[model samples]
Target: MRSLVLEDFGRLTLHHEEEPHPPAGCVAVAVAYSGICGTDIHGYTGSNGRRRSGQVMGHEASGVVLSTAADVVGVSIGDRVVINPLVGCGACGACLRGQAQQCPDQSVIGVTPSSPGAYADVVIVPAGNLVALPAALSLRLAALVEPLAVAVHAIELGRPQRGEVVAVLGGGPIGQSVVLALSVLEPQARVLISEPNADRRRLCTDLGALPFDPGSTGAGAPTDLVIDAVGHPATYAAALSTTRRGSRTVVIGLHSQQVTIDAFALTTGERSLHGSYCYTPTDLRRAVDVLTTRPQQAATLVSTVVSPEESAATFDWLASPAPPAGKVLICFTDTNEPVAAHR
Candidate 1:
């Protein structure tokens, strides 16, 4: 098995190692395409404390099943699927409510060093983490299901109504996915994306969203709903400043560990603020459903695809001042064909 291992902080090296065999209650997936998330870039650059040296860092992924252990009944060989990655103890209340991120015992496959992620030819995951993809969705597009699930979960939390003034702070993968999700759920809402980068703002506009550059101009009119995809202190303040007296604010970004927020902002406005992490089981299903039903908007999220050998340069470029406007995928397999059917 060829795997891209993080040799150290700010370094990624591809190594040829023996393939891992799935133990009981697990399955091995032949990874097709894995998306490099902003979190992955931060981890690669050693900004976020989550990623460690010599770890295989990947979570957003899609592939075909290679083999399943004896006890794994639902997943099987040749099944095209997207990995959920988040795992929690089944007996916990959070897990019972399908909110694994809140579980104290939760650990993600790619983020946690103990479990290797999808940055290789094959990855081993528990049987329950695999979410089967539809026959119509291509494997490349299926790689986006994980991030899109995050967007879907945030949207559900915000519960923004139609014709409401909706604003998203960052126009990256999650923000783009939020725009697409809103297009489906709240088409009548006036969606505005605040991004400084020209390319990213244009891409948001292309997705039928209005662009508001906060770099040149101050935060726009106060909105009814604000989805802050950039989790910095400034964006946090902007989220509060831009919301009316009574509004909904959903935070989906993991950029910063902490933000200094004023108590008066929430009290003065009577605003409801919620922190959204990973998706629920229902949100994951909705993400896959949206991907299957709306192929065009979902397909536009992918910007580039490269092979495993290009891992180092790709990670470096992604961490640089200017990354691609859309999602950058690393393909582990030779055949990047669409999964037309899976029995």
Candidate 2:
């Protein structure tokens, strides 16, 4: 197996290594495609400080099952699946409630330093974390399930009403996913996207969202609901300031560690702000449904795909200023699994 290792904060080096075998209640997946997440770029740029050298840091991915331990009954060899990544101790209270992110001992496959990730030819995942893909969903588009799941969870938190106006505070992959979520789940709701980049704004517009410059006139006018996908202090303040009184706002981006909150803006308007990080089990399932049904909308977010050898340069480019508008995937071409771009 070939693994992409984080040799340093800003460098990723590929090395040949032995393939890992799955243990009890686990399965081995031959990776087809792995999406480079914003968190991965932040880690590569040494801005997140959550990733470290010698760690394998890919989480958004899809693959075909290679092998499974004896007790893995739900999935078998040759099944195409999306890696759920977030694993919880099933016996815990939070895990029992299906909120894995709140589990005291939860471990994300790529984020946890000890576990290998999908940046390699294969990844070892717990059987429970595998979401079996239907024949309708292609493996390439399936790599987006994780991030789309994040948007699904955020939308769930915001709970936008029918025909209400919703503003998304960025036009990156996650922001684009949020628009797609509304398109698939609640098409009646009008969506407005604030993005500085022309390409990103156009992508959102093609998805039936209105694109506006965040700094433009009338940009901060109150809307029924606002989702701050950028999560900077500026965007956080924008979310609060742009949402109408008694409206809801959800913050999903983690670009910065600390954001200064405006007590007056929040208190006077009586706006409710919600923090969303990852998806629950139900949200992940809906993400698969979203991709399986509205594949073309999901396909638009997959902007580029590169081979494993190109992973380093791809990471560098994404971490650089003004990266491409949408998602970039690292494809492991040697895998027998099909990696189709669209239906």
Local distance difference test values of all predictions, in order: 0.87, 0.87
Taking the tens digit of each residue's C-alpha lDDT, what string does model 2 give over 227-302? 8888898998777767789988899988888889888988998988899979997899999998888898788898
Model 1 per-residue lDDT tens digits across residues 52-126: 998898999988888878788977688888898999988899889878889999889889999899999888889
Clashes of 1: 0
TM-score for each model: 0.95, 0.95
Q: Give the TM-score of candidate 2.
A: 0.95
* lDDT over C-alpha atoms for residue 279 of model 2: 91
Where does candidate 1 stray beyond 4 Å?
213-221, 336-343
Against the correct fold, how does model 1 do in TM-score? 0.95
